[model samples]
Target: MIVAATPADYADRPLYAPIAPMLRRFPDGLPDLATLQRLLEASAPQAVSGGGRPVRFVPPDDALPAYEARIHASGEVPTRAGDWHDFFNALAWCVWPLAKSACNALHVRELAAREAAGLPGRGSRRDALTQFDECGIVVVTTDAEIPALLAAHAWEAVFWQRRAALRETTRFLVFGHGSWDQLRQPFFGLCAKAIHRVVDPAWLRLPAAERQTETDAWLAAQLAATLPTLTPRAFSPLPLLGIPGVTPDSEQADYYRDTRQFRPRRA
Candidate 1:
């Protein structure tokens, strides 16, 4: 079982250690644009094209128009203005290439579908969903009861009453750029929130520390193993605080209350 390293030990830990296996050939320090591009090419050669042209992730000066065009064209995710944030975002893209692509595709598909059905614009649902897509984690569980609890909005039962089941069956997959960076200095507001998905009948039985490392490693390997073959999931991204008994005025209250997209299972 892996032991939790002290904060002092974290000083020497590699920032990109989570996805090190996928980006196996990068240099030993913080990556520049060239280093990042090489890492991306090494991890997913199909994702990087246009030779020297800035296509996927560009600076905000170019990103504004790119984002606007992408809203219509579903091309690529726009990069933010800052250096560090954009770099983290690029790494997130590398880590969750398929999911990221799926998210972009869904955005385009939903827009077209809505227009064709004579439905109104996305308004706030699309915006909220995009925020979660950009900075959310997906928690997949193998236990049947946990999902039942989640569906019923039985927060106390899932999180507290059956806490062991939650620990034993959960696989937390990080997909957001902000969530990736927050791993360095995690806090309440920027704490890890997840989209719950149920998996097949299999359980993760491991010590806490070992489980954490194994989960990261497993996610990295999964990304490498299933890229072009990945299928879209019916992911419902909600905040940790949104769990029924966790908070009264949850940040995602409106999102959870909305029946159009998220149908809360009332029991």
Candidate 2:
């Protein structure tokens, strides 16, 4: 329930910081299908569906094939008009076209494999893919310890003890449209499934736009190579509020002590 009348309404919100570049494209109001298609063309000319067809945004319709199937069989993405979730999804495609297509391709492959095996429902691989699609965050950093701490659920160690180091070395990029939608009204319990990438420290010095572009390319390649063996275990849960500076409350050491959100790692 984000009720923003226009993209600009939420542009300055801290949670929307990751997608600010996409938001800037639509200043006046929510983008229509045509506008989205145009933006896609401009931003990612080579962008295609899982089946290699050119990607295009389209209004939602019952007559269309199942969501992922349609994107795989045809390039049309069913988008709901004026919906925050769908808008962020389209923006995700624009920003991370190759990665998104790889995800769609993985979904199609998983679905086909399940059918061939006579499985009646989605399998674990598909579930993991969907979970990441809905709430994934990419944590790119030069420091290996940051991710290691995160994997161990060492909240204070990662967010507080290494706060300055993280600011200088890591970049958290949101890849989940569902997470983006939920961030519209951030809650203390909001968390994301993070996949970490240890990049060269030189990347930290690149301009903001270049950094994002580089990340998009790197992520696409990583997904293409790893999707076959990817699983839920590959992700580490990160409570959004515990991230330093994500919220003002997080600046206080007490914020990380909230056991309700920053639960201890299981024995």
Candidate 3:
């Protein structure tokens, strides 16, 4: 009959075809771990980076039950727009706020490449974490910051799992945000079993020592060439000399606990 479909009619179309079936997969026709993961994998699937690593689009099984509980608990299951956004919200909450975002993959992979090339990189990169928060920046701080940082470390474990799959990486400096001067006093003695070299914020504050050192000059020069956004304000030692300053961790391991323990002490 060549029926004319109006805007409302057109809007009724599903963003994904199998969504209804997926939603119905559980015993009582509710959400299931497999379907939720499948939806995430299909919608914004992540690919292997630098042409080295197994494809990982699906959320790990451990992550799925938690995701299902969130949406069902939140009661935000979308019948109008599409089920995927609900799924996206779930992933964002379960992982990072930006897990569905393409930039999550793009930014991490791009940063990884720069680090592999032996360039200067920032560690304790909490700003990257803040980018996902509702409040863009915090003029002042609060107790909530520690939880947020812990959450970031948890997601970082998943991200690092994907890092080992990356083949082209040789070196890169990865860190989150902290303060300007409080390094040794606040940074703790970060000597470790997994990642040995931790850069203290105070080390960067030392100028006279840096100019005279060979390591400082090379790192300064490399970081400049690699990342234009993060120019060094002062000289700092390379944290990834013998051990990787910011080695990505495996998603399926004790990596989350291992990771959060090392994140630069929060302000």
Candidate 4:
């Protein structure tokens, strides 16, 4: 049974323990990215090459053009399959932080020693980063924000960003008016608005204690209708290792089984 709790229920615990222990259940959950990449190297190193798509780094000088072109090409415009990949690519930019971590992992492996100059800046791996951004990444998936996802295979970065920002009392105060839906157009805007619209800025300005109580109550209510796993956690419930793209069949799910999930079972 779902409880009557609001997001604050999970967000406002205490200075030391405001975040609860994440309840994650997956086949493989790496504590850190380095360990995860090592396992990938031994098991399915091909993933490093993006399933053989020939990933190239956007030259240090040309990275901006590539990224800018991508942003402009994917503007609120429509196109054929040839152009859809590029559009999806641009939409995935939000996952840059996670990808940055992975690239950092690679840099650590390639270089035996490092100078301050030798550190891997975002410059050296823009291509890999872009691809991961373009293709949907496998993250721990959840319900509260699922309605805002653009495609079944990919998630809406705005949702994760919202959840992250709301955890803090102060950030929640400033960004309260901004919802994840504002970042991407959901397939069902009416449904998303009906559900997410209920939480407004009025609730944001409540006393920390009050906000916690109210958010917990509200999220708890949402739990009844959504597949939301309450508690502090990583990205989501899935064992998201790195980037994961859409797979039509198991034969295609070659990147990371731990992160790749089958379609959610709908009753």
Global lDDT of each candidate = 0.49, 0.84, 0.29, 0.27
Question: All candidates' TM-scores?
Answer: 0.56, 0.93, 0.22, 0.20
Find the 10 residues in a row with the least total lDDT in model 1: 1-10
- Ranking, lDDT, top scorer first: 2, 1, 3, 4
Which residue runs does candidate 2 get wrong by more than 4 Å? 1-5, 12-18
lDDT of 3 by residue, 186-266 (tens): 232222111112233344354522412323234324333433343221222221211222233223345434433435433
List, residue by residue over 1-267, the lDDT tens digit for candidate 2. Answer: 355666877767655666786787777888888888888898889899989989989888898689999999989999998888999999899888878898899899889988998998887778788888889889989999888898888998888888899888887888999988887778769999988999887988888778878887887788768867878876789898777666777787777888899988888
Clashes of each: 0, 0, 14, 12
The order by descending TM-score is 2, 1, 3, 4
lDDT-best of 1 and 2:
2
Model 4 stretches astray by more than 4 angstroms: 1-146, 150-153, 156-198, 219-267
Error of 3 at 211 (Å): 52
> lDDT per residue, candidate 1, 60-153, as tens digits?
4552543533534533445553344566677755665545554555455555566898999674434544665556666667876766676565
lDDT of 1: 0.49
